[model samples]
Target: MAILPKLGRAIYVLLGGILFTHLGSYMLLPFFAIILSTEKGLSLGSTGLVLGAGSIAFLTGSLLGGFLSDRFGRRLTMVSGLLIRGAGLLGFIWGATFPALFLTNLVAGVGGGIYAPGAKAGIAALASQGTKTTAFSYRGVAANIGVTMGPLIGTYLHTRSSTLLFGGAAVVYFVLAVSHLLLLERDCIGEDCPKVDRQGIRQIFTDRPFLYFSFVTIFVWALFTQFALSLPLRAAQIESARNIGLIFTASAVLVILLQGTVTRFFTKYLHPLGTMAAGIVLIGTGLGSVALSTSFWHLVASAVVITLGQMFVMPTSDAIVADLAKPEQIGSYFGVAAFVFGAGEAIGNIAGGQLMERAVAIDYLPLPWLLYGALGLLLGGAYYLLRLWQPLAKPLAPVMEERTENNPSPFRPKQKT
Candidate 1:
C-alpha cells in the first residue's frame, strides 16, 4: 500500500506479475523430484540429473533472454518467455517418460530464465533513483509472499491431483503472458533508443569491476542457497521433516514482513555498498552460528539472522546492478546477474552436498557450517575491500539527462553522482 504512491502503475503491475510468476513456479517446481521418483518410477540419480539439466537450461535461457530483451524489447521477451513456460508446464500433463519430463523441465527452466531478466530490467527502467531500492525490496516481499504460500497450496493440490497442480501453474503463466501483453509498455524503442552495440555487449563480460561485482554475487548466492540445500538436511538430522518446513516457513514470513522496513532503514542510513557488505557479514555470522545449534530454537534464531541479511542483500544487490548499468544495457546486466546466480546456486548445491556428506562421514556435524560460515565471512570481507579499491560505477548521467529533456517529469528526482 505504501509502495503504490512511491512506485507508479507500471511498477505495481510488474510486482504483481512477479508475485504470480513465483507462485506458479514454486507451486510445481518444488514437487518435481517427488513426482518423477514416485509416479514415473525414476531412480534418485536420474531425478537429480533431470533437475541438474533443468538448471543448466534455465541459465542458458537467462543468457538468451537478456540478449533478446536487449535486441527486441522487454515486453516481447517477457511475453515470449511466459508462453514458453506455459507450454512447458502443459507438457507435465502427459510427461510419463524420462525424456518427456526432462524436455518439459528444460522448457520450463528456459521460460523462467527468459522472464526474470526482463522483469528486473523493467523495474529498473520504471523506477527513479530514489525509489529503485524500495521497488526491488517490494519485489522481494512479493516473491517471499509467493514462496511462503505457494508450497502450502501446492501440497493440497498435489494430494488431490498432480494435473491440477501443474495445469494450474500453466494457466497462471499463460494468464501472466496475456497480462504482460496488454499492460506493459515496450522499453528502449523508437529514435531515442540506443543502438545495439555488439562491442558494448562484449564489454559486459570484460568489464573488470562488473565482473568482480558478479564474482562477489556468486558467493553471496552460494552462501544464501545453503538455506535451501544444507539447512533442510541439518534440520532433518536434528529434528524432523516438519521442522524443516517450519524453518523455511518462518524464513519466508520474516522476509515478507520485515524486508521493506529493513531495506528502508539501510537505504536511509547506509550507503548501498555498505548495506551489501553488512548483509554478507550478517549472513556469514548466521551460517556460522548454525554450527552451534543444538535445538530447533537455535536454528530458528539463525534463520532470523540470515533472513535479515537476506533482506539487505537481495534488493540492494539488484539496485546496485541497476545503478551500475547503462540505461540501454539494464536487461543485459540483469541477465548476467541471473547467470551468476545460477552459477552460485550450482556451487552451493554441489559444495554444500559435499561438505554435508564429508561432515557426516567424519561424524563432525559442525564442520560444514563452520566452513560455509568462514567462506561467507571471507567473501564479505573481499566484497568490502573490492568496494574500497574500486567503487561501483555511478548511474549514467547523460542518459538520464536525455530522458529528462525528452520527457520532463516533476516526479523524477535528481540522481546523486
Candidate 2:
C-alpha cells in the first residue's frame, strides 16, 4: 500500500468517525422526550426529570473530557469515549424502565461528550497551513452525514424493536472504536493537543472575543436543538413523513455542499458575528414559520431556508475560533467551544420537553411555545450584544515558523487577556 493514499484514508477516517459518533449519539435528542412521554407511559413532568438526569452526566463528562484532552492527548480520549458510549447504549437497549434508562443514558451521554474535543483537535492537527476554514468545513460535512444517517437507522430499525435499534448502534460503535484505536496515527492530535499548559485557561474565559463568540455559539446551537424537539413535533403534526425527511435531507446535503463556499465568502465580507446573527435570525424565522406550518412542503421549505442560514453561519463560527486561538492553545480553545455546545444541548432538551408537554403542568406559567419563542428572542438579543464589539477575531494566517530573534511562537510573548 502506498503511504500517501493511506494517509489520505486515515484523515477521512477520523473525520468520518466524528460524524458517525455524533449520529449514533444524538439521533435520539428530538425523540428521547417524546418516546418517554408518549410511548413509555410517563408523564411529561416525569420524562423531563429523567432526561435531565442523563444531561447532567453528559455535561459533567464534557468538562472533564476537555481537561483530560489537554493532559492525555486526543487519541486515548477518543478510544475511551467510544467504548464507554457503546456500553451505555447497550444499557439503553437492555434497560426496561425509567430508572434503568436514567443511568444508562447518562453513561452513554458522558462517553459521547468526552470524545468531542479529540475529534476537533484531531482535524485541526491534520490540516495544512491556510486551509483551516476548508478543513473545518469538511469536518462539518462528516458530522452532518452522521446526523443524517443515524436517524434513518432509528426510524427503520426501531420499528422491529427499540432494543434491536440500539443493539445495532452498539455494534457500529464497537467496530468504530476498535478501528480508531488500531488505525489512527499519534500526530493527528495536533501540535497543540498534547501540550497541557493550563497557565492561560482562566484567561481564555476572560478574552473578550472568545467570550462573545462562545455566547453566539450557545444561542445558535440552542436554536438548532429545536430540530430535536419543537420543530419535529410540529412537523409530525403538520407534515408527512416524507416531508420531514426532506427537511433534514435538504439541510444535510446543503451544508455539505455550501459550508466551504460560505466560509470562503465570509473570509472576504462577513465576520463571525455577522454570520452568527444571520444564521440565527433565519433559524428564528424558520421556527416561527414552523409554528404556522400546515403542510409537508411548508416544513420542507422551512428546513431549506433555516439550513441555508446554517451554511452561512456554522462554519464561520468554527473558523473564527481557529483564527483567534493562539497556536499553542488551539486544542484547549476548541475543547472549550465543544464543551459549551454539550451544555447548551442539555438545557435545550430538558427545557423543550417541559414546554411542549403541557398537561403535566409543572409551573403556574404559560405554554411551551411561548417559552420557546421567548428563548429565541433571548438568542436574538445576545446576537446584537455580540455585534457591539466582536468582529471575526481577524484571521492571522498559519505562518510564523521563521525565527524573529525568537522561536516564532510569536503569540506566546503576549500576556493572557
Each model's number of backbone clashes? 0, 1
Report the poorest 10 consecutive residues by lDDT, candidate 2: 397-406
How would you encode candidate 2's per-residue C-alpha lDDT over 241-354 as one tens digit per residue? 545656677788888777766665654444456556666777766666665567777777777777777776666666667667765566677778876787677667767766
Deviating ranges (above 4 Å) for candidate 2: 1-10, 26-47, 188-199, 233-243, 288-294, 346-392, 395-417
Best by TM-score: 1
TM-score of 2: 0.75
TM-scores of the candidates in the order shown: 0.92, 0.75
Find the 10 residues in a row with the least total lDDT in model 1: 393-402
Candidate 1, clashing residue pairs? none
Each model's C-alpha lDDT? 0.84, 0.68
* Model 2, C-alpha of 52: deviation from truth (Å): 2.6
